[model samples]
Target: MKNTTTPPKIVALALLVFVGAVMLGYGVSRMSAQEPQGNPVTGGLLYDKWWTVTGADAPVGDHPLWATQSTNTRTGADTWRCKECHGWDYKGADGAYGSGSHFTGFPGILAIKGQPVADIVAALKGSTNPDHDFSAVLDGQALLDLAVFVSESLIDTAPLVNADKTATGDAARGQAFFAMCTACHGPQGNAIYFDSFEDPLVIGSLSSDNPWEFIHKARYGQPTFLAMPALYTLGLADSDVGDVLAYAQSLPGEPALSGGGLLYDKWWTVTGADAPTENHPLWATQSTNTRTGADTWRCKECHGWDYKGADGAYGSGSHFTGFPGILDATSKSSEELLAWLNGEANPDHDFSVVVDEMALDALVAFIQQEMFDISMYVNEDGTVAGDADAGRSLYAGTCARCHGADGKIYNFGSEDKPEYVGTLAVDNPWEVFHKVAVGQPGAPMPGALALGWTPQQIADVVAFAQTLPVE
Candidate 1:
């Protein structure tokens, strides 16, 4: 008892050492178990617009944090999005948003990568600043997902991407990877125009000018464009995304052959071109594709889905018109085709006033270079002329992704008249063949021709598809 009382300072020092050892061990454990396996793609979308991702009601009024910053004129729910403040490149005011319509002086979270996950999580929860608190809206797991994405997925893209925003990966191998994307983006990635009317922004432009933004969209997908799938959810490696960027950047910057296929299919819907005040001058010529208004105006209606009017699918059916096939037009020059579209060759065929110069040129290019005869592969009765067994193999490689192994994942038609590859192959082989060759009109559906699938291979696929399900 006397010895214990004499060593009070020594006892205090020993206690401090034990406490330090325990704390050090805990810190080491935290390091070992840092980032979780949450999806960084989802995190990016959440950063873009959490309410849109979560399907939550828009937050009432402006963001509470808006009071602190007056530089950004945007108000209401937009002020609360993480990317609105932190920026898409994850550098806030330091990166692309340094002085755009999105400018906000907020510091980006990119510098916090490899930092303690707990600290990041704490910061998200407002441990560092009460003004930054997100716990009131985001639950624990949401906060954790954001934290993990920031800590582990925020890559140093400067090494992988150039100052011009082009990626530094292998583009050759990336071409094969791009097949998964062709269904929606088209072969050249020009299916959709994202920006304004005056300056259309296609995927190639987006990829070359802003690869970080491209990768972010390619990884997580555009929240606004739900049809575009996230490659990350499909288990693509990080390198695969980079490779895709490299390949996508290599695609042509301008729209090319078959670029106007959708407009040809349904110009009214595809171009959003205002309907003519008067019925088409040619509407009274022949009315087999007995549709009204905009439907009648689709080039596919009069010319045929097979692009061979009177000699193919629309030859003698309810969809028929007495119009000549476009196959012969393919041999014509661009000047000849332009004349045909501008009323010089055929007054009724005039589209100069309906579509702009670029659009007219695309249509002309499609007619001059992309048109082909597919009647040999498809029968009048919708029977395909290829080996069904070989088609089964083609289906495994391509169609299985969205159509499933048995081809019933998506119901393209209404529930009452359910559509599937089998049904289309059996009932409308010409339509299927056209879609396979040129991609679906108004959609980036896979074009067999672009992916190097021969007409025979497409026939084989149709043969296999016919064996699937009628209902």
Candidate 2:
């Protein structure tokens, strides 16, 4: 009893238990944190990209890091992103970025995972690495959030994804999970295009080539696209994210268009194309549609919105012009349609001098593949045969933004002789159907058909719109 000094092993064991208890207690405290924690997903997004998150322009020139190296060859916004220097792997050049277009001679920050969160925050603020200052671009909270993500949230992603960028998770589960993504990304991830006309990238393409980058962006909602929600913030676990990634990677890739449908709707807005300096040549041929300039240049103007030409919407109205519709011509061979477009069949109908072969082909493809007859949905009495209930909902989301809630927003005619959307839908539904399907010429109204709305859905909205204020 007098020589009762604790053994060295007992002391070590007690210390181990003490450390474990402290860590467990700390973990519980963080889990039960009463104050609002910053959005680490947004932090990750900021790490991958700061300007997009902040909705600011690229930091008005080079980032501080760009002066440090000249070999990487990136500039402006690319240099400002934390991952540009650190990396999507968080390993910077020391890992996946060690060799590639992204290779920067910067060291990876993965070693800082277990480092003190405060220390990480300080380093980002340039307290340690003088050249790595991010305070100019990010606020304190953003910095702390970024540090919290780097120190506590970043998981090792290599094992979760294969070299081919396929996720190791269950794709089936991801498919079900994809429903949440579709509200914005769309059913096929084609709702939004990510790049320019010549080089386009959609969500499918982005997820396929750079699974790591996709994972990073997916976890954090896109900075510029504020509507996109970060799944991580929605309580998804790492495996859950991997599942979504797996499904996204498996999806097909299709560029929305090089400018086909829009050109079909109205051609001048695109680059290298000049707006009509004079009324369209066809304008002199008819005076029913009183508008001039680009409006006259639109294909929908000559071919009624119904594509029925003098046979449909514009058949008897003041807007009528003695032009033929494209319905019959649609059955013509591509060569025949191309010939028609090139003025081989109709000299006055020629667009050959205005648009090049590629543009002309796109227009032809649109006419051949997309232009549909409206007679199926529009009864002769002008009553829409679509489900009005479904149409009401579509109207709220897509149409009500321009038209008022009661659908009386725009009076496409004079006050004494008004032409409300309801008037158009109820009295001239054939016009409504064509306009809705192809999009209104000269207006930025979306072509419901091109936007993936079903014919029935377009009918529904048109029917519902008929119930709006006609007076």
Candidate 3:
């Protein structure tokens, strides 16, 4: 009779125990079902590993694409691998190796990252290219693994890159974070020379030109380099990468110059000046004066400070060229200046040749640095005389060889519209100083550096040029 109440409590306790066991079993089953099916990290590793095309065997026929595309026919097992054709960055035709002999114009596979695993597997299994079928090369599991990694891991870089080819991030913060990258890349990030050309893929140049590739490489680690750690593994945030890009973009791209040396050995090739006139005395002296593809050979022959021909120093002399002066050009705008170079004002003054892109840049820099007004010194009468005694000594050293002791050897001016070195010297000392310092681009006139002359020496030369005849 006392045990009847205890039996009811025991039954309730048994029921609770049974319910707890059932709940534990269901939880374990759910976890087992949700576990990762494939290893994507391993798949990324397999994707980078290359496969040989023929593998130590001689090719039977001329490679079908070789005659038109590439001369490289000695195919290895790894030669035709996807990674070999497309870069690790997955920008095949549009990216790093877009141009040159290796250009295949193949679209990048990065865009297919989020595609279904079945489609990616099909692409690998002879569905894309019969010649490129890799089904036999890799197992099904390996293919599935690769597809999983690509689908999950690949990133788009469009948002990070700017129109100016620079990274849109905080440069100052990036500078602080870029220290780890500077070891192999140098402090300036231009240390690692690649290819036979010894061309350094500098941080500044890469960041400026291709920030997306930079970020991908930075996060994934380079495929070939085992020592390099994946930044993703270190848990670096997107903002950190952006900061690095911004910092890299701030570095200098071009190397420092050796004080403006002649870019090309030939001065004529350096500056695209007008062609020399045949009747000019200077043209008769050398074969260079006659042969002309570009107009980079006649800078000094025209636009003499002493604009008068035969009336001043450059007229009847060895240096004389009966060419019109650029007396009116000082008032012209930049557009007009460019037009003059293109031969709009004068048919014989075309400058397209000899001046390549870099040369044009240098020329533009020169023009921007030198052009100025010189109307104050020149008089209406054309006779110029600020300081003849000071001018006489300067002329003897720098000008006497071309103009003669009297400054009347080459008459640069005619009777009607007279111009002479003396007149220009008195009138436009500023123009004379500019020419003397820069050494008229295409002309043989010695640069002030070559002449070992200072600004004072150039000014002194201008003073002497002013004493020469204007008419």
Candidate 4:
């Protein structure tokens, strides 16, 4: 009772304790009410192209921040992609985009790595600069994802990739990983042509020229191509991605022979021309093949898929014509081949009226460089002269994925007839050899030629294929 009335210090201490407790309770309440964190994988994809993932129409005009950069000549949607300004390496002007056409004098998001996620979210919502805001185009969840990606998923490619655009990992390990990619991009990485036909571009060239871009695309799936797998989601480590890039850089450049092989199958399709309505000038010479109009104009229709014409697979079928095979003609010079195509050798066989000069040159290359004498690997009875045991492992690695273990997943012929890989291997080994070496026309099947496989290796795959069920 004596001290209670005079203890102002104790009273002040009691008041401070009450205020501190109230503040702690409020902080916990705010933290508990915050939105759940976003997915970094989805965030990575969004960083590539948000509209594609969201199914929203791309913003009609340039991003507000785009006006601040004049070095990059790109406009509209391209100007808005985060990678366009910050670079594929995410180091902006300090990285791969420093001097190229993509340079934009912008800073990278790498500096924000490991920063508070909430702070990044605020910055994305225009807390820092109004021009940097992406709130109008993305919802709260999407913005959070972008922030999470910036804070958690961004890796400094500097240590992984060298200054000379080479990967700093083991290429041999990378080659094992590349087998998964062989289905879409052939073994030499030239199955698809990214640029114009006149000046084609393939993965081999792309990786060597821009390793940073290659690393980005390899980690995340391609922007518009949904079928492409993202290695990050597949559990590939940073070192693993670097290894794959190193192997890919060693692949062959420009696919001239592959392009020519496609032309040999259907010239009009490869050239993007409308098929001629009229039959070929020489169509009247062949009565067995009833196919008329555009069918008669295909190079394969006359020369055969094996390039042996009447002497090979097309000799006795409904596809038969008295036409001579072009295998022997492979010995002719480029000038002679051009003369035959242009009607100098035979006016009726002239193809210059349909295909251009460049196409003719490609045909010449195919005949001289790509064509193989199938008789060496395939016997007359449709059996392969190869080691089936040796081929088993090769086929399992290369052909089994698409064709299936039994080689019966795809039916090349009618459903009732059901022509599978086994059926073709047994019935038309010559055709098989040709297709195996040069790949299927307009299909994703990797050819042994593009894979740098030996003739014996191809023969081995054929032998293993023959052992599968024909039914």
Candidate 1 stretches with Cα past 4 Å from truth are: 1-41, 49-52, 55-81, 114-141, 164-204, 218-248, 255-257, 274-278, 287-289
Clashing pairs in 1: 183-444
Report, for all candidates in order, the number of backbone clashes: 1, 3, 34, 0
Write one digit per residue (lDDT tens) for candidate 4, span 1-471: 122111344334333434544553465457547846676656788888889988889878788888888988889998888888888888999888889799888988888899998999999888899788888889998888788888887878887788898889889999777765765576577866665445767888888888887887777666566545566655678898889999989987786254677778777867778888999999998788899899998888888877788888778879999788888887899999889888999999898888888888888888888887787888767778998877877776557656878988778999789998989998888778878887776465656777667778888889988999999
Q: Assess the local accuracy of residue 334 in candidate 3 as a C-alpha lDDT between 0 and 100.
A: 57
How far residue 8's Cα lies from its native spot in candidate 3, in Å, is 68
Runs of candidate 3 with Cα error greater than 4 angstroms are: 1-105, 136-145, 183-187, 190-192, 209-212, 235-239, 252-471
Name the TM-score of candidate 1: 0.76
Worst 10 residues of 3 by lDDT: 256-265
Measured against the true structure, the TM-scores of the candidates, in listed sequence, are: 0.76, 0.73, 0.37, 0.70
1-471, model 1: which lDDT tens digit per residue? 022111344334334434544554465457648744444556767777877877778787887678887889999888888878887678887876778688778887789988877788899888988878988888766777678778877755566677667688889878766765654455677654555323556778888977878887887778775545666555567777788889988887654334566567766555666765565778888766666776666788778878888877777868777887788888888888889888898798788878888778778877765666777877777777888888876776567645777888877789898998777778888777777666665554556665556678878888889999878
Off by over 4 Å in 4: 1-82, 92-94, 98-100, 103-107, 115-150, 160-196, 221-252, 256-258, 271-277, 353-357, 375-388, 402-430, 466-471
Q: Name the best candidate (by lDDT).
A: 4
1-471, model 3: which lDDT tens digit per residue? 121111333334323433544553465456548862433434555556522211224234433333444633335434444554665457677765466554666667778888887787787776776654666657666677667767777655545567556677788877655654542344565533222111334567766766765776666555554333345444456777788888888876642221112331233433334433444323444442233432324444444434332333444445444555554454556566666665665555555443544454443433443433233333344443344565555565445534566666555467676666666555556445555555433333444423434444555456667656665
Better of 2 and 4 by lDDT: 4
Ranking by TM-score: 1, 2, 4, 3
Tens-digit lDDT track for model 2 on 185-278?
5556655556543344677888887788888777776766544556665556889888888888777676443356557656766433678777
